[model samples]
Target chain A: MNVAVCVKQIPDSEPPALDPQHHTLVRDGKLVMDESDSFGVEMGLQLVEAAGGGEVVLVSMAPCGETRGLRTALATGAAKAILVSDPVLAGSDALGTAKVLAAVIRRLGPDLVLAGTESTDGYTGTTPVQVAELLGWPSVSFARHVEISHRALRVKRQTETGYEEVTCPLPAVVTVTAGVVEPRYPSFKGLAAAKSKPVEELTVVELGLDPSQVGFSGARQQVISVRAVKAREAGEIVVDAGEAHERVISFLEQLKIL
Target chain B: MDKTWVLAEQRDGTPAGIVLELVTAARGFGSVVEAVTWGPGGAGAAAVLGRYGVTKLYNLGDIGESLPGPKVAAAIAAQLAAESRPDAILIGATHDGRDIAARLSARLDLPVLANVVGMDASGGRLTSEHSIFGGSTVVRAEFTGAVPGLFIVQAKSFAAEAAEAAEQRSLEIVEVEVPDTGPSDAARVVTRHEEEHSGPKLDEATVVVSGGRGLGSPGNYALITELAQLLNGAPGASRAVVDAGWAPYAFQVGQTGKTVKPVVYIACGISGATLHVVGMRAAQYIIAVNKDREAPIFAIADLGVVGDVTKVIPRLIEAIRARR
Candidate 1:
């Protein structure tokens, strides 16, 4: 009864600016675990706890072979961590990412896998399903609630109209939506334990996967260019110490449709 | 004319509104448009296909009950394998639609472009335009695969319209063998609990009034609800507010939420994170009220009011009441 929760290390969403000339995010400082994955971590911990004696494992692929993001998840009470880091893994497309993650997940042999609906930076929302496809397992996306019973996984999946109740056996992939649950904060004891939690690092070759098939070399899509946008200038802002609402009404009147 | 396909969904035994919208979008590529869906109960639902001028309807017809995602994708792959592939496949970016697209991409060894706002066919390839980084920018990409380019277009991008005259189209009613994939077969819908809701759906509202973290507390959301009611608008919440439990998921408006193109969108106490802008940037006119003039919402707003929502909202309501 082990659960593998996939987490991502992302540049702060509110960065002052990306590196101007490089067309890349400024990863110079701390790269935090995306808040998007917090639900998955929390759900994984709760499920493992409900299962009586299982462990929640953290899995991630970080740039510059980083582990700070993994440590962030570990601080939430995950038992261990696995990171796939290699220079060759840089600039991979969603498919290439699914390939690397699938290979690693296959090796871990977890009964259930959880991932965020999408990363804040890359919200493609395709990698988890691709991983499921690659593993030849079942997949459920947009999951709002999940429960494990009788070697099966049941979920409340969000849809456009409303939602539906769905279930699949163990060894399936479920992508959790944000705000599904209130993620627990890392306790002081949990933070201390995370410092020593076993982190196993791996490369493409170690996983018996071809380096050529794991990264930029194998990517089917590439970003042609990224340019900083000159956002629209701020409009007429009326600072109303007490009459701001009246000023807004007059402004709307000026538009001839007040 | 090249053949194009739409993966349609059904609502209350009729083609869903978004499905018709997608069919309208597919009309741009070529005249030969078709639709694929499940459920035998939707035979009359097949007539809505005719109204959209879908020449052919590929109905798996409920081979698999609720977990029809994998089976539908399998049926599509089987069709593509057995016959000439369609030039493009347009799918709604709903939860089930994404599941179908993902499984199809995996089965076909092709990349599915998700979150496309618009699309075109050029030189035998489908070019997709996607909004990225909170809709401040957009990127154009083309699928370089063989036939059957997969696109998951965002909802509300295209307006749904019925054809001038309902054209009687060819119907291809074929049942597919639901392959028994081993354990971990995509989960099945065992039970359902829909949040009881009433009011205009968020994306369909002409007037939307949204709140954000600036509302201060969950209790403060009462102001937003009352303001929206006074304005005759649907209530929306920034992702931050919804994430903080001040509002429910249905009230969220932002990236990864509903993309709304209302006639007038009023922001109450919203700081306008780029993510929220990405979702509501299509509004015809935006009026934002935030005490901080530096809030990014002002950058795109037509009129910006620097005042607290609690103060400004009640005053505006009074003004509207006295004037009306």
Candidate 2:
């Protein structure tokens, strides 16, 4: 019942400054773990704990400075952390990122892989499905709840209408929505224990991944440009000092509310 | 030059709303629009596509016997890749369409754009516009490789035109048996649950009435619904209301919820978070009603009524009914 959680280091949505010049996010040299990925990590931890024997591995692709996010995952409950970081990995979009993740999952040979439905920054919601395609595995996205039994994994997916329950065989990929579960914070003891855990660092070359196989160069899709949205104009407020009923009637008449 | 291809998603043998919208959006490009569908064997899904001005319709007969993401995507991609190399592809940004678009983009080695609100071809390149940062900003982009462009059109962004019903024409139905690249490990579809709501959907409605956290509790949702009914439109909610469990998540209009481009959007008891406003900024007209005159929603609202929703909504509903 081995499980792998693919995490990404994304720019915080509330960035100090947006790089308008480059039309890219400027982190001011600070990288934060995507909040959605935390749900995937928590799902992995829950599965490992329920299985009572398998391990939960945290996998990520980030720069050297991004190791702190991996460390934080380890502190939370992951058995170990694997970092696939290199200069070549920069500017990889969802598809390329999924390819790298699929390669790592193949190397680890896990029974199940879990990922967040979408990262907050990119918000593509495509990586997990793409990764599942690359790995030739079944993928269930927007899974709100999951139960892994001996032969199959039962899941509840949130749809526009209502919740859908589905059961798939083992060795599959599941992408969880934020509503899936509440992530746990790293405890004091867990933080100390995480220091002793092994952290394997792998470069693209070490993973035997050809430089041409991952990143922007390998990605099929490219973002040609990004522009800031136009600022909205302020509205005129009509404040009438009248009785509550009179004011309500007058406002409705003006707005054609009636 | 090879023409563009549009995947016209159909449910139960009829083209979905977004499919028509996709075709309408792609019509201005002036490329040969080939509509494709994967449905039950011998189903007349292809015949229906012709009404949408699809020059050619490819019905890859029921590849998976049921609508599964990978199976449908593989079948369509394999056919499109082998038969006609399209210069670009368009799909609706629905859950099912988005899944297939991602897989198709990966398989075809093309840049996949999602949530494109508008697209125009200029200087031999297609520039697609998308709303980012919860709709606060609009970004235009283009693909940069030999591969064809792939885009997922945002829902309700384009108005769907009813294609003229013409004489029945037979379309080529190519059946491509996708190789079992992987085991069938997906959870089987056991049952489906559909919510019953009257009136038009909020995203497509001409007028939308929405509630926010200012509506004290779930019980107050009736006021929002009454207003929507009076307007003969649809009801919507801000993320705060949905988060508060006063309304269903499907009714939420925000960064995580549905993006709507309606004619008139009225926000009642909403403070207007950027996330919420982004979803509705594309609306032709916006009106905000809140007790706090300085609520952020007022910044983007075309009209503002500074009043308490609890007092205003009931009176408005009564007055509208009285007029009738």
Task: Pick the TM-score winner.
Answer: 1
- C-alpha RMSD by candidate, in order: 3.1, 3.3
Question: Please, what are the lDDT tens digits per residue for candidate 2 over residues A30-117?
Answer: 6777877898999988988888878899888874546767777888989997888787876566777777788889999998999987
- Local distance difference test, candidate 2: 0.74
A1-258: candidate 1 lDDT, tens digit per residue: 899998888876474345544333555456789889999999999998899978998888754677888887899899998888787776566677788788889988999999999888767788898889889888888888898999888788876545788878878999998888889999999899999999999887887888876554565554444544566556677887887888767765665445
lDDT string, candidate 1, B21-134, tens digits: 889878766547888878756566677787777878777666544565677787788889888888889998777788788778877877777788877665645577877776
Q: Model 2 chain B, TM?
A: 0.88
Residue A41, candidate 1: Cα error in Å is 1.4
Off by over 4 Å in 1: A12-30, A223-233, A247-258, B63-65, B161-177, B182-186
Model 2 segments more than 4 A misplaced = A13-22, A191-197, A220-229, A238-257, B40-48, B63-67, B162-181, B240-245, B290-294, B305-324
DockQ in order: 0.50, 0.50
In CAPRI terms, model 2 is classed as medium
Residue A72 of model 2, lDDT score? 79
Write one digit per residue (lDDT tens) for candidate 2, span B241-304.
Answer: 7756677767888666777887778899999876687678888778787889889888887777
